[model samples]
Target: MIPVQEREQTDDRRSAWAVFLVFLRLGLTSFGGPVAHLGYFREAFVTRRRWLSERAYSDIVALCQFLPGPASSQVGMVIGLSRAGYRGALAAWLGFTMPSAIVLVVLAMGLSGAGNQVPAGLLHGLKVAAVAVVAQAVWGMARSLCPDAPRLTLMALAATAVMLAPSPWCQVAVMVAAGLAGARWFRPAQAQAHEPLPIPVGHGAAIGFLLAFFVLLVGLPIAHRLFPGQWLAMADAFYRAGALVFGGGHVVLPLLQAAVVPTGWVDNDIFLAGYGAAQAVPGPLFTFAAFLGGAMRAEPSGWVGGMLCLVAIFAPSFLLVFGALPFWERLRRNAGAQAALAGVNAAVVGLLVAALYQPVWTSAIHAPADVALALLALVALAAWRVPPWLVVLACALAGWGLAPS
Candidate 1:
């Protein structure tokens, strides 16, 4: 008979593998961005698998939302970590992230090779679709996050500030200012008691992860300046974008635009087109990084660049989730922290609003027909409740049809 220890080890491996398989399915099929991804996760893990109690699941979601990164992706990582330790976390991330990342990278490469052959109408349609998607996000987030007058006012101010300044540092500063304003003025409603999370990480390990997160955040830029390699610079830019953005995948847009577009690393058209295509795929929207990486004008611009960017952007999420899980209980319970987070969330909505106007709106909406298409896309997304991927496909066809013969 197998020894008891050996049997237990085998079981652990099986558990990790199971986690990966489940999330791989999710990666392939889950759509509609972060909020929808959360619903898919809830159905798969809580209702179907009964992996954890509803409260426990919610608590995990809250913790991830409270921290920076893609909330849905972080939620998946936490669920996996709870089930089978660190190995399980890695498996979950790989399974959920890879499908979308791979798709975007391949798409980017194809667009690059297609060059002048790619239909202008199709590309334009994708940009129009992006405008609608960002508008929907802004609308939805406004309703949920800016319900109160104070928060609404804060959101408008943040939007105005971002639009006026329009830089990565400006965006980060706005979030910080909003958080401070929230801590001072906003009083968060008392939180409901939550079930304790089942994360297996200890405080020491958590601290180590947290330290690593900061070290990389600070060290990457300095290293890039000193070494000045293309790969290092790309890693630094992607890492900073991943680490700083408070909201989910959509909020990363302006930061990413600033990072790649100005440096002549990626053209504005390619960047926006990739973003538009990202909406059509499953899993996290952050996989747009893969597209940008693959489409870069310089060396390491194919699969190698794509993988580097995918890893760099997502690295912080892993570190933050692992680091924060242990201390999340106390942090969540802190009223001040909750209030500040509320403000930060409000700011996130505003930041998205600015992005909608500048890059998404200005780039896509050139004529009356484009406006009409955007309006229709928004209606389809927000009112008809049509699935996003379907809407994206329809828009692509419409754009192609409208192209000058």
Candidate 2:
């Protein structure tokens, strides 16, 4: 007779492989941003497979939403963790992220050879498309995040601060201020009860992971300065961007733009084009980092750089999810924490609004034709129910055709 331990091991192997295959398919097919991705996840994991109850999945989603990094990816990781263990989490993330990361990296490498030969109008079309995408994102986020007057006020003020200062440090200061203000002013009446998902990792491991997250966040920049390598610098920059993102994937755009564009790792036009390309792909928007890393003018540019960046950008999500899951039950019940998250969410909306204006709009819309195309794209996304990939393809064709001879 087979030993119980051997049977359990075989079962786990099957579970992990199943998780990978399921997520891999989702990664290939899922699109239309984070919210849609969440819906897809719910359909697959809850409604279809019944691996998790709706309540349990909601709890996982709530916890991930509370923490920073890509919410959908975190949700997938947590689902994998809940289903199997750490290996399952790793499998889910790899399966979901690899499809887009590979596509963006390949696109970036190809673009690197073409260089400035890329038509200005075509690039502008991308920028215009980006403007439409981000605007839709900002509108949706504003409605959900800043529904009330107070949160709306916070978002506006935060956007104003970023617009005036317009630096990475300035952005950090704004978020910190938002969190503090949120905690102080936005305390809720009561904490809500949550049915937390079971996590196998012990509390001590969770604490260690949390500590390591911050350690890397603080230490990477210093290490880059001290060590002085392109790879180190790239890792530091992408890691910091990943750590600080509070809202969603769209917010990562400004943070990443600040990190790489200023350092000349990627130029302004290339960065926006990659952003446009990212919207065209399936899977999490975080995969754009792979494109940036691959397209860098510095050493380690290519697939290696892409992999390095993909790992660095996503490392924090793993850390935060693992760390927070242990404490999520208690954390979810804290009214003050929820209030603070609300404020931060509102502030994030403002930050996105600011980004939509300066880099996305200013860089992309240089003509009346550009404005019209962007408006059309926005309508297709927000009103017409057109698929994002189709919309992106349309924008590219429109831009290419409309380019001045």
Candidate 3:
């Protein structure tokens, strides 16, 4: 007969494997930038899988929004952690990140020789599909998150502020201001029953992780300056970008461009080409790091550099999410914290709204035909309730057909 403890261990392994497989699918299919990624996560975890409750999922989103690095990716890591401890967290990150990283790296290598050859029509189609996906996300999240007048007002103001200023700092400032407003005026009627997040790390471990995060943030630059190696320099640059940026992948572009372009690590044309190609693929836009790494005109380029940059850029996310969860869980239970989260959640939705309009809309919707295409995609997603992956495929074909022969 098998031992009970052995059986439990086996089950835990299976759970981690399951988390990996699910996230791998998401990595292959999740499209439409960070806001749309959140919508995809909500559908997969909260609505479809029932792995997390609605409020629990929102709480996670709210927390990730406050941290640096990619919010959607961090949410995936926390979900994995909740399911199967540290192993699950690693599994989630690897599965959800690798597909696009691999694709972008390969594309980067090919483009170096083949020149910028990806069809512009296909890329534009993907952007239009993204419009529908983001609209669906905003529509659904608004219904759930902004049910009250005060919260709705907060959402409008936040969206307006972000749209006007439209910087990473503005997004962070809006969230902070919204949090203060929530604390002062938006207290819940009565304390509702709480759904405790299953954070496996102890308080001591959490503190250690936070310390490590800061240590690397500060020490990496000094180490690079002191040693002057290619790998260390790349790590320091990518790590700082991930650690400091507030808004998600889009906002990180200028920092990345500055780091690589002026130094001639990557030619300016290749850099812009990779950014365009990044939108054509699924998964986090941060995977553009893989392209930059693979295309670097220096030693340690190709697959080795690609993987290294990918890990370095995303490392802070893992540290921050793990470190913050223990403290976040405790603080969220407080009555005051709940009120503040209410405002923050609304602000997050607003940020999504601004993003949907500026880059997602302005970039994609040019002509009446483009607007028609986006509307059809939206109908497929929100009304017919088709899976996003299928909609993306359909739109790509339509975009190709519409392109001049």
lDDT of each structure? Answer: 0.92, 0.90, 0.81
Residues 145-200, candidate 1, lDDT per residue (tens digit)? 99999999999999999999999999989999999999998887877767876678
Pairs that clash in candidate 3: none
RMSD of 1: 3.6
What's the true lDDT of residue 38 in model 1?
95
User: How many angstroms is residue 390 displaced in model 3 relative to the true structure, after the best TM-score fit?
Assistant: 2.9
Q: What is the C-alpha lDDT profile of model 2 across 1-405, one tens digit per residue?
A: 888755644654437898999999999999999999999999998886777898889988988889889999999999999887998999999999999999999999988879878777677777788998999999999999998899999999999999998888888888888988899888777766777566788999999999999999999989988899998999998898889888778999988998888888899999998899899999999999999989999888889999999999999999999998888888888988988888899999999999998789989988888889999999999999898888887898899899879
Model 2 RMSD vs true structure: 3.5
Off by over 4 Å in 3: 1-85, 107-116, 189-200, 214-309
For residue 221, give model 3's deviation from the true position in Å. Answer: 7.9
Instruction: Please report, as a residue range, the 10-residue window in candidate 1 with the lowest summed lDDT.
Output: 5-14
Task: List, residue by residue over 128-153, the lDDT tens digit for candidate 3.
Answer: 87777667767877897789999999
For each of the candidates, give the backbone clash count.
0, 0, 0
Off by over 4 Å in 1: 1-14
Best candidate according to lDDT: 1
